[model samples]
Target: MDLRVLEYFLMAAEEGSITHASELLHVSQPTVSRQLIELEKELGKTLFTRTHKNVSLTQEGLLFRETAREILALYQKAMRENTGAETLAGDIYLGMGETGSVVFLMEQIAVFRERHPGVHFHLISENADRICEDIEKGLLDVGFIMRKANPLTFEILEMGLRETWGLLVPEGHPLENATSVTGKQLRREKLILPENSFFQSELLRYLGAGAQERVGATYNLIYNAFPLAKASRELIVCLGYPGERQGGLIFIPFANGKDAYASLIWKKRPVQNPALAAFLEHIGHTVSE
Candidate 1:
């Protein structure tokens, strides 16, 4: 298929309206509409659901959107590599979750940038699963994951810091005054936990069998569950950092020796960009030291 047509398809898909995409692309609405029709015809699938004013991607279209984005990204990366700039000049995308080790990562980033200022870092704050997906799709160069890395798929470097798992509780809760809590103590309370298979598995491993039944709510993003914690007296299980305090919330560490660890992970493939290579080298040196 034509790359230009794919660009039009992606623009329409993103904007959710052909007219809006036309305005952004500085092309006529009819032109974008015609290109989209041609793309759908060439692909032999209906990519979008049409309405009077807006459009939405169909199931097939959603799948194709991911493929199309990867295609465009690969094309851009190829162009940058071909430029052959002497200075390190390319984008480094990193996916991160809520971890205190972010400060350490940023310190290393600062050290790297001091010598190569042309490199730019793009940090995407997301959950572990989403970060893994982005890394697999080649959209992100590095990921900070709380779980152990898959030895088959990833090259791992531990951050040398461990995240102490804890409870984020509101005022007047029974466990609010406690310095640290046990798994049995946590099992007694209604829990609001991170909505990830690996995280849930780890929690269950720590809390023992039948603890899954006590989970009241699961959230993809930790902070999004704050409202639920406030509305009820439920407890949230997450990491506790030094001097870190949230408004109307208190964090108490878990006493049962269940702490989450972070690692800098990347796909086991040939290095592509100079910036990524430098960052990887820096991580290796940092971890070694």
Candidate 2:
């Protein structure tokens, strides 16, 4: 429950040894061990599995690790923002999905940071669903998602960019030279597709009936799926970005594809941080111009 104890728990988890964690924390080994014991008691869960040699996280500890990290990050952010109230400076956390439209967002961030040098940016790359969740949780100040903004929950700014859905085929494959591929043609090949449920549904709709049978694997990020696609005959269904090329792979658009639009979204609440407010205003002016 204590922040210091959380730090000790994380250090022990990372080092796998109470001795090593105490050495790093500038405390005695017994102190680290005692704190961990108290932490486990407070939570009523055994967090670590102990051995004579080292310690490892139990299933509960593994889940708690993520919660601890989020707690620490949020605390640090609050401290920074509150302390820097007199200055237009603090961290602005942003989440984004993989999309070419992020180039426009980065441009705005560059201009904003130039005017407020003390302000910093932290960017997280994730799927739209995860990004939305983070924004809702106050872990992110803004999110660039590949979907329409939910007016009820978020204040939105249209990025005015659309991503083309396409196939990432291995070089020298039969479809490499094709200008565009259709759903019927795709049904003949095993395909690697995005793991996001929203996008998966859209893709399935685009591919028509019985197209799910052709799926070979799913990927959270397209780059990770590239090698899987190259090594085998599997085609990767992903968004095509401008001037982006992968070695040993060819990207061909889907015939009459449904393009995914990009939107900048934040929680529909009062903007308490001046840095975030200024950044949003900058984006509005830039987008309008």
Candidate 3:
């Protein structure tokens, strides 16, 4: 339960050896072992599987590792924001889905950093749903999402950028040479699509009845699905950006398809963090100009 013990546990997990962890921590080997043992007892779970030479996480340890990281990150963020009271210095955690609008956001960040050099930015790339969840949990200060934000829970800033939806076709595939594809045409092909339920519903509505039957797989991120798409010769239904060129793959737009608009969102709450406040102000000014 102690943060120090959590640190010791993480160190041992990373190094896979108690001696190595102790060496890194500048603590005695037995001290590190004791702390880990105490941690396991406190949690009432065996965290690590021991071997003669190395250690590895048990199934429970694997899950708890994620929780431990989040706890530490939140603690670190709080400490940074509270300590630097005299200076405009703190961390701004931002989550974003993969989109070309990120280019615009990065440009704004560059400008913001130039004005407040002491402030730091942490960028996390994830799907829109995950990003929104983190913002709601106070883990992320802001997020760039490809879907509309619920006005009841979030303040939204439209980026004025729209991404076209399309299919990623492998070379020599039947649809590779097509200029544009239709939903009716897509229904005939085995498709890989985005994993978000809201997005899936929209696509399914466009594809009409029985379209769900043709879905081969769903992916949280598009890049991870590219290999499977190529090997299986399945079309990937994804957002298309300008100047996008993938070797051995072709991006063909959906004829008359609805575009995905980008939006920057944050939880509707009083601005407490100075860095986040400045960032929101800068974004508002940038958008207005």
- Model 1 lDDT, residue 41, Cα: 90
Model 1 spans with C-alpha error above 4 angstroms: 1-85, 242-244
List, residue by residue over 27-63, the lDDT tens digit for candidate 2: 9999889999999999999999999979998978876
Candidates' lDDT values, in order? 0.81, 0.82, 0.82
* Candidate 3 residue 257 C-alpha distance from true site, Å: 3.6
Residue 84, model 1: lDDT of 60
For residues 1-289, could you state the per-residue lDDT of candidate 1 as single tens digits?
Answer: 7787778988898789999999999989999999899888989999999999999999788778757765665666677678964466656889998667788899989999998898889988888888887777666778988888678988888877887888888988877778788887765788888877888888778876668888999887777888899998888888876325666778888786567788889877654455687788988888898
- How close is every model to the real structure, measured as TM-score? 0.71, 0.71, 0.70
For candidate 3, the 10 contiguous residues with the lowest summed lDDT are 240-249
**Would you list the rank order by TM-score, best first?**
1, 2, 3
The TM-score between candidate 3 and the true structure equals: 0.70
Error of 3 at 42 (Å): 21
